[model samples]
Target: MVPRRILLETGLECFRESLNDLHAPATCATHLIGCVTTIFNFPPSTPRSNAEMDVMVKAVEKHYEFLNLAVSFVAVPRTSRQLLKLTTDLAKCDCPMSHPGSTQLHDLGQHWVNDMACKDVTTLLYFLLFVPSAILKGVNKTRVAKGSNKHWPRSISDIVPFGFDALVEALSQWTVVLANPIPLLFLGDALHVCGRPLFTAVTTSPTFMDRLISLLRITCANMRRPQKSEQLPVSYFYIIAVFLFHVMAQRTSQNSIMIWVRGRELELYPILSEAVTITKDPKLWPRTVQRDATGIAMIVNIFHAFAFHFSKDVPRPPGLHPELAPARESPEIEPVIRLYDLLSTRRDECYAPGCMRSLQEVGHAFQKCGACRKVTYCSKACQGADWKNTEYPHKLICRQLQSFIAASGSATGHPKDNFFEDFDQAEAEAVTAPLLAWVKARDAQKELQDLEKSMRGLAKTEKDEGAVEMIPDLRSNS
Candidate 1:
């Protein structure tokens, strides 16, 4: 019965020597894996709180001699599935290679790093970069020699033992296993990344976005409970809302969200209310501190009804829903840049309503909106229709986009990340009108639920309701 502190100190000493000296990388990796497996793996049976458990687990990772210098044990054995989790904590950090003249790291005669001064996640990435490709090749070799003619399963995610940490890493390893020849990562911006046929196959699949939404619903459900039994940390949910806004938050999902959202507003409202409600709970998240998760749960979930996009589209309409846009004194926003200034921005389709023509079909000729200059039109007619059309008219939002452009100029304009970094009162008030509406709807819902519970004469609390097994599935359903 050795003290845990002694084990910790001894392990740290061993880990320091192993990493700094580059002395037997495999042995060190295996040792740390065992340490992490025994000391860090959280079972429901564990006595400690999740916060204390998290602190202990994070203790294994330490800063080395240099400031940004850190390392991770990346020699993953196929059998040890729990150690593969690199979400929540690692996703926020980016890995960049160090300078030219530092001690080069060599593993099996191959240089893994030129210098030691790199972030912990970077070290993980460096080692993991090759391991996945190798594992993939070895798997193929086994299949080939065995004369197995079975094609890769479409439900590859269901069969995979580990949930991949990075989406790129997943694509790299799983795509090879799934036998996709093209690499989608190297393709440039969001437009290019979303456009690839192989990428589209996964994104455009009927079940893809449905699965994503279900998982989000499941997490939100878990958070509503009193206990700390979460499938994922808050950060992952924040990232999902920000990155997948087109699918998750947007109203127009007809052409492509790329798959599921499909403008089903009823299916969206319940989750949004739950997400906002949970983040407001002091028992769940601290009231004094502001979390990006709370901000995200607010910003993205604020009325799915396009409140943020109203500046002034047309003359007074009788029965339009009220929005949180600025007061309507401003004139028509003149376009900022000329035809040469459009910058292509990798857009393939026109921004105007009812314009189905692609860049390819339209001979790559498109004109920029004069006011905001952010939107492009395939022709003058479609642009005109989008501006004045009563239903979801683009005319209302043009000046708002123009204002964003004005605020977000390059070296010439204010920084894009300024007000958004903190997600303060100013930002909250900007969307305050619709957010208030959402709060009212949620209150109404709570009253109805309470009434129903009273009629039933009994109801289990949320804790009891969420006590069922709800392990999160972050794995891509390829």
Candidate 2:
């Protein structure tokens, strides 16, 4: 076998040759200068340093090669757009499945995409931002129909699908590298690209939604703290949590619509509650900050998308009997409309008037009753008295309330391991009667509210409007 020293010298020579061939002379020289500086700056050699020195030397050699490679690629002269495409190809080529040895190559692709997206955005910003007066001159002006609006730069409807593809691919790779959140940043850019003006097609696009939700679910389930009690990286927690919150709120809404139609209230209630919880969390900023914001905006976007689609796209449940169709003609459909309206409105905003303060502070009220966990307040003091006073009346209608929200998603079909399914399992295994009671009570309260609304409307037409209308009269008339 060759002596170890010979092996070391050969390895160093290979590194040097790679630099010579792949890099420009000036670029190569610059790296060599850095390497030389590092070498001389290496402290005086001692007797204790032979093995360590060899390892250190190899590390320095690798750095030299990396610097050389970077310089070489820079000197190769490619437009930002060409470089962007090249980097995308490189990323795909270096995907962990295809080129495991160059897995780090993935990072290079990420960096390139980031640079190009940012640079392109910066160029556009410069034109539109500083020189809004010249916007007409910069563009070849033309009128476009709503259906053909994808061509506009401001709308970015054209780039949305490409952005979706990029996000899906990046997130797919992210399952393998949770600690490096660089890919999520790319997902964010894609999100922004799809979100501007009216790229509703991108979010609603069936092709992209599946992959997006799949990535989100896996990312959330994989989050774990590292061993040795070290603080897990911030990116790990942030990316997973944000993704989970979004998936629970947005994707599930779309998926749950079919469930809602199926009339699976037992399975659907918890999911709707969870969705509300995610949206209600004040710690979550609805707005994205440039640094930690990319994947998050998708949450807000998808929520609105799901709501819009639910309003315009969802068909009335066919299961409703012929007799109920007449009820649809009544103005009392207002409460039912309001309930559907709640699905489309931001939960915080929808629930705001019901409570005196925002849900985060002193939460709307009734948050204190053991039955009121479904209710929330900004603080404990608000919860305390509110619970005692409302508990008895609220208890009567809690189950109906939960059932209505649950119906929002569970009406379609019962999905295994899904939110609806998990809720059923939770109900069966529930160890605490109080917890179950609270769930039941919340649903009941919602039913009472709907009944009250229906009765109140009927009362106006019949007897004393001053007296509360009878539930029996409204039910019999229906």
Candidate 3:
């Protein structure tokens, strides 16, 4: 048998050669990236080492093949675009059941799509969203502060802006989910990071949310009643749960859901309630994430929180069970909306009262408010009107956004786990409750005021001056 060192050297050489193949470098690189990800599943306690760090750095620290590591695929612009191109190309495939590897390829596409969706967002926010990045960014920031300015933190976008922009441009040109859901699986993971712009893209796409929700509904249905031919790929469950947060973010999305729920085109509350049962039973998912208690809770709570949050705005049909609304207030409901409210608008649409035009309809980006830097409008006039509107005015929320950076303790050298997974959501909602209650009450009061004014208009006032003449009417009555 070959020695272990020899085996390592041979594999490394082959990996290097495959990446440079002129015929199909992108395909070769994609497979390599995909397999390592699929094969090496491990829990948090699994041991790891820094040998997997930068190859060049490791080589410098010891004797090794530096040349093989020199031409990183991501460093070259052509290769970067090729990486994304691979996803688009693979999306065209139908993923026949004959080859189970096709499913693995589809899973790898999810990771690629997540990266593509997130690259355009602000790096600071992106770092906080992911679990690992939170730790890394904090350490990196402290180190940077201790060092000189030149040693400051940097991201791929900072060093390779063109490469990054090319990836985003490629993404825009290709409409995902029309052909396959694989590449777009975890795309919504970045929604909270990219915020309003990403939210607008999801809602306006027309087919994206429809297809996602349909798949989700089908997945849940299949889960409820098992059948051979009706079975769907298991990835749909996780992807749908993560991606559907877009529907929970804003009023427009909730309005669309209202239509769906009303027509019985789609329903989520029942499925979410079933999520606990579906995720808990090992016979259901076996050794996957769903089998774990934490995973079960996370999946179920995510659905419940989102559904509960938008419960009032998006109504359920009469006699729908669970009421879809768990409580009058939830940590996930109003505060989450308010904290992320800066990005809660449909960014491509006009924010003014009378005109809710879209960039797609108008074929251009709209003007934005300079003060809060939070909203956009069709024109200066619309912006002015929105700012001056008496009820739910943009002016009120603009400065609040300025004060609301990340969360209460995110940038204050404290961890951001609380803002996301770790925070005690039930307890904290109380603090934001009074403010939230006032906002809702004020909205209801405005609605009530409008109703009263309209009803009063039905009756003539003392100022009614129309005299004309019932004389003609009197003759008719006689």
Candidate 4:
């Protein structure tokens, strides 16, 4: 048997060779992934010194650069438009068993189609999961203090050359891939790995925010449609709800809530309601429900709070159904309500100690600090005065304040584990009762309208038949 040192050396050399080969990118990627996986899962029997382990870790660090190169070689488009086109192509090519002609297709051909459609996305998912672990493997724990920013695990984007725009574009591409449930599970894992940064980037972009919200709305809307409901992946919808929940929690502005609500509280409510329904469905994944419970609750409660907050300024949508309003608020939603109240109240207070300018007094005209966004000033002069002040200068503690707000939003005193330990099925149903009732009432209303229209059409037809019969009699008399 070859010596262990030689084996590791040989593996390292092979990995290096693969990275240098530009022509055979797929081959290189496959080889590099194999080598990196082996290094990460290095066997105990293979004796190695600490120095040797460090060497192996350093070797694996190159994997990120190689991954970006491999992706580039695959010709994955960089621009949003091109990525969208790619997404469309993949979605169209994904053949479900229910699709006509899918059954008759040869197994090999079907497999080829599946691979072609899923290749890039699967590669991306693997990169997201593996690269972070690889980078951390080489990190010196002794040098990094516990609870320090350095000790906190970094995202794949933090290590790689991939920009925020590229990450968002990749996420957009996966939004289309979600049409197929099988690939969507993988996409969810990828999202979990990169979700924090992606959420931050998405919150900053109005266009991306709109696209994501539209995707959620369309997906949930499809779930409500009888013809399309079976084809719809309810699990994917749950994943999206979780994603949206994260986005909503981190959003720096209340306007984000309004933008998402978009006068469609009637439509948005059921989606949250159904998410709660799916969470309790024994046949589905319960962990998804647990993971998403806070977000779902937060959004539903935020909707309620915003409705009350903007009741006067934002005119109620025309023909707003009474059933859409909650019959009664649940105590469980109080935390979210309190959070919103706190946010709204805090925005009115000037960050500067001496200045007294309120958001209520001036409205959205108040200027928020560009960096942390935790502070607002009524004018540039107030902002300048606050920044230059010797006592509690805004510049000194802006990042700390921003961090505090971020932490509060994410934590929210919600227990991550055993989320439903004390909460029973009966209680779950009780909390969701209003939303479920609204959905039922809306659906019933639709069915009633459809029935009435059908009846009206039938009566018109009968009248036309009688008129036709009279026409012949009139002709005979004439």
How many residue pairs clash in all the candidates, one count each?
7, 40, 0, 0
Residue 152's lDDT within candidate 3 is 15
Q: Write the per-residue lDDT of candidate 1 for residues 1-478, one digit (tens) a residue.
A: 3355554444444434445532123223223322232233223232236355445334322222211112122222222133333322332422121312111111211221212222333333323222222122113222322334143211222112232223333333322221221122111112121222223444545544454456557656555556533222343345344334322222223334323344443454455545555554556663333566546544444332212222123232233222222223321110111111122222344666666444534544467777755577788898998887654456655654445434433222335434222223334333333333333443444465456555444334433676444323222321
Candidate 3, residues 181-225, lDDT tens digits: the string is 332332343333233444555555544444545555555555655
Q: Pick the candidate with the highest TM-score.
A: 3
Order of quality (TM-score): 3, 4, 1, 2
Query: Which candidate gets the maximum lDDT versus the true structure?
Result: 4
TM-score of candidate 1 against the unseen true structure: 0.36
Model 1 lDDT, full chain set: 0.35
lDDT of 4: 0.43
Instruction: Write down the lDDT that model 3 would get.
Output: 0.41
lDDT for residue 323 in candidate 1, whole number 0-100: 24
Off by over 4 Å in 4: 1-25, 28-77, 80-120, 123-127, 130-163, 178-201, 204-207, 210-242, 260-270, 283-331, 334-478
Pairs of residues at least 3 apart in sequence or in different chains that clash in candidate 3: none
In model 3, state the lDDT of residue 79: 44
Candidate 3: residue 52 Cα off by (Å): 14
lDDT for 220 (candidate 1): 67
For model 4, residues 1-478, the per-residue Cα lDDT tens digits are 4444544454444444543543332222223433434434433222236555555455555454444443332223345565454434433333333322222222323333233333433433343343343344334322221222242232343322355455455556545544332322322333333333444555455455445545656555555454532322444554454344334443445565565445555554554455445434444543232344644444344444444432323544443323224333434443343232223323444556576544433434466789866477878888888987754466655654455444443343324232222222223333344324433443454465566566667667888788322212221332
RMSD of 2: 20.4
- As for model 1, its CA RMSD to the true structure in angstroms is 22.0
Better of 1 and 3 by lDDT: 3
